[model samples]
Target: MFAEHLSAFLTHPVTATVLLVIGIVGITLELLFFSSGLLAAAGVVGFALYFLGFYLAGFVGFGDLAVFGIGIVLLILELVVPSFGILSVLGAICLFGGVLMAAADPKQAGIMLGIALLVAIIAVAVAVKYFRHRGVWNRFILKEQLTTDKGFTASPDRAFLVGMQGTSITPLRPAGTAEIQGERVDVVTDGGFIPAGRTIVVVMVEGTRVVVREIFEQNS
Candidate 1:
């Protein structure tokens, strides 16, 4: 029976290609790609493809088990634990081995890979739209910001920072630390280099945008 199945698999071109693609993508992406919305979707899709191909090739038991095992491990690693890369790799290895053992034909792998990728895209899109407007997102994002500072500088006539003097404390690789009004603040230079220990004069503070110029008050 095994020899007969091998002969049939060898004669099938499309089946072999699909299996190869699904197997390659399922294992490779699971291990190599970093965590992000797109990658997460891709990973699931790849696994689905691998499992489907496995079933079509007379490997039903192996294919279903592979899917279940990978799903559980991924859920744990993606949410429960802070760790990511290592567990993903382990799951991927299991996936690859499972597909190889169960699938009689290597070609159907490509077709399954496509199904997995598409599902991932749809899942991520739905998640983003649904979660974006929830108060949870707002609370999570703004918890660090102070309540009073949220809209204090709304009045344009009250721009009190126009003539402020500051000292550079960070290399400002164009965007670094500067001391203004006895407080350290993040500053940026537009095509201008401001080295550490330099004196800068605030020429304009137009609508939260601070324009500064280097002063040689000492060098002059």
Candidate 2:
């Protein structure tokens, strides 16, 4: 009968370990590379087979499958929702718990799960480092470099505005706007207030900061 074959598969630790490893690694690959959901679908199928085998053989109950399903839901939510690893940790716990519950032997299941997790970690590290074409990773990372030739500057060179005469449009209570060289420039005074409409001269230009001093008119 189908149950006989299913029971045999679950009873053997080697085949069972292979199934768990394949399931975990498939999901891991899908998460890391996003292979158009192909890997994810395969991984889901692998887990479905695992649960189906155990359930059909009467080794695991519906509640065990429910826990596993909940774990899968939590892990999927982790991809969309930012929980700072809380969801992932909880999901992993449920996932491992469900697997152990379904297994013929809890101790063997734990050992196999540990092996699967270790393999998955090593695989991810190798893929990230050696693999050049990261499917969805490219979309998240900005590989383009902004250079001067691309008309990008950290700050505009305002040195040309030095020695230019202008009038303060706002009270430069040490920092205000002034019209320099026919352009409105944000200039700061040398620790002195210059009221609006006062004549000011640009004394220094340091990066984006334009230093200005007010000019006093001479009267007879």
Candidate 3:
């Protein structure tokens, strides 16, 4: 009797929406901090509870779980490997599809996801504004700029690199070095490998990340 009530409550629209928000916010925090495993664990627990509740109610299936798992793998790969956002898009689709599959109806799924996403976005914005210094991105980047005498020169804005042609200094199996505008810059391919000494072009530049693509000649 208690279990039945619990399941019903968990599957309720309000409860499910709250769980989704918690899961999204928790995971976002984990990514932003990348510190102790606590945040990640908490996010996982939120998702687990939500899924378990649905499962207990017989609303979820193995296929849905598989799709969700694939989405997770793709998202992880997107973080570890740069595919120019392709993996991110596909992963998001799969994740949403999985959740929708488990939802009681399409309208309910849309409303829940929309609300959860909006709340999560606001929460993340607040967290970023207030906790900028504690972000994990700080760990990977060098904040200090050294003088020229130190033999390390700070790079100027790279926005101009777009549309510039260059040569690959090393084989880019997605990420490698390239010589652009007489400067050796670290670059990543859209999603393919370009051998060393190949002609390449800067396709896009986001902050310090320079994306390049191989140039192929067409035979007349």
Candidate 4:
């Protein structure tokens, strides 16, 4: 009796399409926008109603609902934790499988899935472009510029060290310490090994990186 009532209500093409659109939009907004989980909650409710309607219409069963719920949970986890795309992929697979299984016609399912995917992609692109500029997004993004004008310097200016002669104080298997101009400085060789006490010439000094070469090799 319940199934017959649900079928009557959902039998209208317009009604079913509206429900599907609502579900897709809600989920897309939840995933793309950070709304303190409010959007997520609304999305969950929308999807639950969608699945319930299908279940009552006899198009889907409890098994399909379970799969869909698991998929939603996985997606939520993807947002909460960094899974390196693993959880998101699994969630998408479970969601698609559940939707396919509940759909009576394969052609309709394919069309609906395609539409959902397209909408999701557009939503993500828009969010990435505009959302980061918003004030709320600033709380999550690092917007500070570390520059000399801001009194922020990663290392002292070593431009004067360029062209200076030095001796390797430690073996430089690409990187080691060197004594240059009566001061100890960290240095790196240009793909060459230099033993301790070997004479070296500072070839380049860029910020904190002091690049050097063997003095003997330069003459030879």
Extract clashing residue pairs from model 4.
none
Residue 93 of model 3, lDDT score:
86
> What TM-score would every model get versus the actual structure?
0.32, 0.84, 0.60, 0.60
Which candidate number has the best lDDT?
3
Point out where model 3 deviates above 4 Å: 82-85, 136-141, 147-220
- Estimate, for each residue in 163-220, the C-alpha lDDT of model 4 and write its tens digit: 9999999999999999999999999998899999999999998779999998875554
The positional error of residue 68 in candidate 4, measured at the CA in angstroms, is 0.8
> Candidate 2: how large is its RMSD?
2.8
Segments of candidate 2 deviating more than 4 angstroms:
132-142, 148-154
- Across 22-107, the per-residue lDDT of candidate 3 in tens digits comes to 87787668667764657656766766677777888888899988887887778668657857668867977887788788776768
Which regions of candidate 1 fall more than 4 Å away from where they truly are? Answer: 1-36, 62-64, 75-80, 105-220
Q: Rank the candidates by lDDT, best first.
A: 3, 2, 4, 1
Candidate 3 similarity to native, TM-score: 0.60
| Position 50, candidate 4: lDDT | 57
- Lowest-sum lDDT 10-residue window in model 1: 26-35
Q: Report lDDT per candidate.
A: 0.55, 0.80, 0.83, 0.75
Which scores greater on TM-score, model 2 or model 4?
2
